[model samples]
Target: MDIVLASKRRRFVWSVAAAITAVAAGDVLFYQRGAYGGQTGFALAALLLLAIACRPAIWRDRRAWVAAAAAFAFALQMVRDPGPLPWTLYWVAAGMTVLLPATGTFDDGWRWFQRLLAHALRSVVAPVLDLVRWRRVRRARSQWRFNLSDGLRGVALPIIGSGVILLLFVAANPVLAQWVDRLAGPGLWELDAVRIMIWIVLLVAAWSLLHPRPIQPIMGTFDGSGELPLPGVTVASVRRSLIAFNLLFAVQNGLDIAYLSGSVPMPAGITLADYAHRGAYPLIATALLAALFVLVTLRPGSHTAAIPAIRRLVGLWIGQNLILVASSMLRTIDYVEAYSLTGLRLAALAWMALVGCGLVFILWRLRGGRSASWLINANLAAAGLVVSSFALTDSAAFVASWNARHAADVGGRGAALDLCYLRMLGDSSLPALIELEQRPDIAPALRDRVRYVRNAVLFTLDRRMHDGGWTWHGERRLAAARAEFPDLPARLPMPAGDRMCDGRLKPPPAPPAPESSPLTVAARP
Candidate 1:
């Protein structure tokens, strides 16, 4: 019993130590430096810190290794483009982060994710409880104990030595220096409440990662199959619905094919742009509803699923829905080409593709007799994959550049340039606007408008840098723009009132001339 007590006490001490170490590592990677501050090298370094502090046996677990790989993927994506999607996936995959000590035993990803969430909620008060437990552990007498001398020599000395070594390494290595900007966030004596609060948050997050545990409420299962649950969804009714859904979808696809190929003339009032624009989003909605209908009616374990005839019909319907999704995406593309690409349109394209992937997964589930959990996981994984790809892309910059190339003002034959819209896109649009302003073919009037809007954007960006505190991506973009700018003007006052970045499709009417008076006599040019 004494040995067992000693073992428990020792483990608790290690857990506490590990939590502290994790917190320190988090401070290095995240803290106040901003998202992806350390980038890839620092991210890996932070992971290494967690590995050393976490239980040694976790290293032997395949799940733990898989979790580490996921961490790397998320961190790299953050490095590529720091945004909410990568951050969401980072925490989503973090369910298995280092095979968290108190995540309890789990066989699958879904359970791990559920446990992580349960544990995280409980961990809100974990710090206070852990402190209370520490008091109890301190009073309990044990034969095997860690004394002050032992702690000083064994723990503190090593930490002090390692910190020194780390500092030296950081000085010698640029990557390390970039990753470990120790004490560089705020001044050593600075009292920033926000930064301090961020530190506390990081500590809680790290500690929770190490010692997560809570009642993992009974997870709901996807075994919700059977005719009993979905009333009136009989095999015969399902057959009729599948055939009808397929026919309706076919009609949509057929019309799309005609418009897409220019093989048929419009019936009447619909212009190609209007036809493309109107159908893009609504068709996507139709596909989603069709998917939900399939899930509810065609349970793999149901009587309908047992029949090969029903399966073929359902398969045919899903195939048509996939085609419909493709048509929707093409419609969005056609609309964009006719008008101009915007951030929202780019997102619409990605969202449509994700919907198509969901339809495919639903069909696969029916064919394979996969469980509800399996289907959900497959769709989630697809979404995560798409989101990560998006995180790596610069949608705003892409839209700006695409519009710049295709705008008829500069020589291309697409849509007329809308500098107002480009200005609305913010700093990311600066380079593209600079390109337009420099073009000789660009109208003199348009060039002057671009210069005015461009100068205002530069002023805002420059002011942000001057305001200080480790601005990175923004600063780099501003520098690049400055290098490209022709005879860069001094920082200008930002536009006030409703300028619309100097008007929409066409320039606004020139302000009315003031009446000439003795004191307001017109001056000769």
Candidate 2:
């Protein structure tokens, strides 16, 4: 008993020591470069040696001896080339990362390979161990272990896929390292983005496995008004959902990165490395928090019982719409300058205000014991507003702004309106634009715009154009006008005649004559 107690105490101390050292080593690897390799090597070697020293036959048994030898080899590789080690050595290190366990075990030397190997072992070996253990227990119960096929069907494939990905990621790290090094040449910000992407992928994969479903209270009310014993969510389903959500998040993040890469590049002046480091912790933390939140919210009864779930869904919708708004805003700018008012701006503002007010209303209603139907109707209205913001805002502003801005040069506001009308018809109205150049009443801007659009369509569709022909009702009038002014060029100035200016579309009325009547008014007075 004394010997056993001593063994337990020693094991506890070693485990604590290994963990502390591993953490310190990881920090050094992240922040420092000089002797970082040596530091990591020493940390890993110390843990391995301590594990072996605590064992009785580790020195005697060949497999235990081999593990120790591998640990020694890792230390040697670390010392030999401290700058940048071989790919194989990194693989060896990665293997060690997974083989080691997190908690109580003499095999802590193998913890180095923990991340890569656990999923595989969980996939392939775990079921076998479970089966054997179940058989041992089942004989007494006179019933077979929980359906073998169900166990295999549910857990087996996911574990294998996860393990495969983890290992592939580790193995691909050397390739990733090369890319990182190349990016590092551009400075740290770009490099940092790359690192952030790497860590996010890893984190999303790892934590998604922890809990995939929502977890709700058995007692809904704070005062225990609706307390009831009930079975809650399963861990496996939650894990799967978390994985799917993370994957979706990663794809969106990748799109963001692609978009930013074209414009932001190095984020003002920060080095890619520093930039990457700065964001790494926060992004990982947020993703983990989100995963936890999603898991809890998604748990089968959690949405029904919890108010927070409703708020979360609303918040997510708001965020998604905001992103859509920003994208639409960018696209709108190609049609006009920023200061000019596009109908989209009004539509977007209206949508935002309505949604914001509705959200506030829901919060208020939630507190006031309103029926679920009220809340549902409110949410549905908000969703409709979101869709309307897109459809009503995109093309209407495009055509109206296009007409207003080019009104002076196109053919006054009238010709500009004609172009707007043509645009509304999409590709089918190309002949109208071609015919617009002949109209004597058409503003030069409108005439030029029509011709340019006509040519663009012809080029795009590879169609032949005749010198003079009636296009259609409006098209025939414009074609005749263009023929009368053959000197007109393809480009037209902004038509000055349109009533549209800045944001407003309606034309102002003519001002009353004042000076000419002043003398007559004076005589009457």
Candidate 3:
């Protein structure tokens, strides 16, 4: 009995402590408020504590109740304007997970509830948001010229593109939409499933009407069993595959542009042609030109003609990949707009990696000897290195942009450091950056630049905390700077000047020095 009581007491204490920490941390991080934030904040903390306390009992048999509570929380949060709780449902569910040792607490019933909710939310939310935003946009831009081709292109391109990509996606993995619906919330799940299914059906119908031919396969296109099969899937096939993939990708890629381009600020010195050519256009063109010879050689009984055709097409493909790599590296170094660089690099890298992998696989198949195995291993290692390099390079720019000039708090040093770490983690090779702080691998100039920004962030954070609250003018400047240079790292520094104070700028108070003279005496008495 004593053991049981002690265990219960320990659990309660831990629960309360965790709850307090969560409340305090959340207030500091997100709301810029403190834990003493009135009834709502306290109520949330109480819920967290209750969750922790009942966790073990919940394991004994509170599965249905937990699910019901979670569902109720989710529903309340959705309806309330001020919001009922901060991720109340998630916290409750997570707490229940800790409590429950048994499997299948939700059972199939929980899944059903989830699906139902997801469908409803998507059905309701998306249309409402779209309608409201659309109305606002229409009112704002009343007299804009409607270019017929542009309008048609905008409409047809996204619809067709979404259709094709979704069909391929669904065909590749039928259960994906259903799974997504389950995870995202019932409303989203239902909406997405319906949207995707409708798109798939439309794409299938449209594709049939268009009667698009299969652009020759890049690999496994030639019948290996056939007499005199064209030299093991000629370069033409590879080019054709590349083109088909690019065209398919472009259609899917334009969805965001179709829907959200209106919200985007017009970039300076960027024309329509420039924007269009910047993304998947070059990829599609590269693939198409490289595969030109394959199309010419597709005629039956004219197989011998493919030799010269393959050579020319392969040369073009290699040339295109090389140019893309060079251009991408230049763009990375020069800081040309990320939108242009990222999409281009993504397609180029994926293509090159795929082709390189295929070649290695083919070599392994043909030469089953030890040397062939070693060669394949080398190719795989090179591929991995390339991928890692690309990730690190991409993340360097990402980390750099998080610099800010606010207080050394949520908006300050901590935030910048977190962003840097996030970017570093995204690349495999940059693990040492977290520990070393200054690696020889990072160029001396780049390291200096990063260190300067990091130090500035630390300084800002310290300085801001010294001041009572983040002042309006300072926050505004930080926001404006962030807007102007989205790619640069934020450089919020710790506060240091005389301005940092309580009544006169000081670090926030310690926990009452663990005792007050009167309170301690009274409690003791």
Candidate 4:
């Protein structure tokens, strides 16, 4: 009993030390480096501090290694160039690092995620509650000169009465009140509400990090008997539904093949754009619904999942869904070609690709009889890789270059160039703008716009260079833009026509008619 109590005391002391260290580190990071840098610093410090507070056995644990890797991924965000995608990925990695240590290897991916959430919530308050209980137990055993309750009761009335008498005496005498007020000293130790709240939040976070409660693994299969309990969903009813669902889906697939694949012309009064736009979104929605239905009816270990015919039908249905996803992609491509590609359209294409991959994985999992956990991890891995790739890629630059070259103004086969949109792309489109300006047959208005945009980009580049704000990639691109447009002017010329002088165009100043205007105004008066 004594050994156990000693060990508990030691652990508590260590936790207190870790908490203090974390709070100090947090304060230094916040006050010195600013919030973004401070957050990154605090995360790194807290991770190290927590590892120290935990058992040394963590070094040999697989989850610990995974957590370390995730922490490294998050650290990359602090030093890398600023990007929304990378920041989002960093947050995901950070969450995994924080939660994965407590999450167990569950057969259900959703269960694992749920456990992570539960652990996070428990960790936030569990330490404080445990500390309070420990203090109460310690107090109960300690032999003090007086019991806390008895001491308080004995002094309560005397303290109150002394306070009342003191107030009355101070009210009656101005000198005594002045002397009491002077004794209060300066407000050096005073804290405002905001400061108090900040300290409370900081301490809470520090304590939570110092003593995170271990998550209890939720053991047991999702379907304990290795089968779903659906009394109404018999083999025969499911078979009928599968047949009807397949037929209904077949009709949609047949039309997609005919119209999307160019086997038959689109219906009269419907342009290709109309057909493509109308089908793309709804087809994706249908595939999503079909996927949901498959998961529900043919869930692993279910009675219907054991039927060979049903399994085959589910696979076939999944394949058809993949085909539907492909059709949606083609439709989006057709629409993009008819119109133009924006960031949103590009994102839609990426999403469709991910959906197609997900459907394929679902079929694979069903065929292999794998758990939902496997399916989920595979999809997450694919998605993480895709997002990481996009984070590293300069999508804006690629879009700008593609649009610049494909525009009708550039002698390619597409709609008219939207210089305004390209200009909105900012510094990433600088090289494309420079290229646009070099074209011989470019319209005069577009050429002027390009020149204006190019000047703005150059000015921005120069400022970033001087301020040391350009990343390696930005610096390299700026160098390339400079090399391509060696003779590009430093500033744009004023517009010659009756155009508005809205910053982009510097209209010529009105002639010096002030003298004549003043004489005419005086004569009229």
Quote the lDDT for 227 in model 1.
63
Q: What lDDT does model 2 reach?
A: 0.42
- lDDT (Cα, tens digit) per residue for candidate 1, span 96-185: 654453455554446656666777676777887887876666556544466444666888878999989987897799877765556454
Model 4, residue pairs in steric clash: none
| Model 3 lDDT per residue over 1-525, tens place | 657645644554454344444444443332333111122333343443445344554436666355535534543332221122334443334333332333442323233334334333343344344336545644565463443346568899789998789767856785976664455433432334545544343323222111111121123222221123455555456456646644554453444244224455546886433444354345444544433333333322334333454434444444444444333333332232322223344445455454444443432332232232343344555654454344323333333332222113223422223333323322211222222244345445445444443434434533443343343233443454455446645444443443222112345666655554664445554
Candidate 4 per-residue lDDT over residues 69-112, each given as its tens digit = 65555445433444666655554444444455554552455555
Evaluated against the true structure, the overall lDDT of model 1 is 0.71
Worst 10 residues of 4 by lDDT: 494-503
lDDT of 2 at 62: 54
Over 4 Å off, model 4: 1-57, 83-85, 98-108, 119-211, 217-234, 391-394, 418-444, 454-525
- Give the least accurate 10-residue stretch of model 3, judged by summed lDDT: 208-217
lDDT of each: 0.71, 0.42, 0.39, 0.67
On residues 1-525, what C-alpha lDDT tens digit does candidate 2 reach at each position?
657644644544454444444444433343333223235445445545544554443455555454456546645444432223322343343233323222233322223234344443343334344346545544554343344456569999999999788657746798765675574432333335645544343233222221111122122212211223336543444445445654565565555455434454665665434443344334434433553343233332343335454444534533433343333333333222322334454454444454444545444453454543454455555754464334322344244545444554443422224444444443344434544455577656545566655544433322212222112222332344346657645443333344332212355778986776534545565
Say which prediction, candidate 1 or candidate 4, comes out ahead on TM-score. 1
Q: Higher lDDT: candidate 1 or 4?
A: 1
TM-score of each: 0.76, 0.23, 0.23, 0.67
Provide the lowest-lDDT 10-residue window in model 1: 32-41
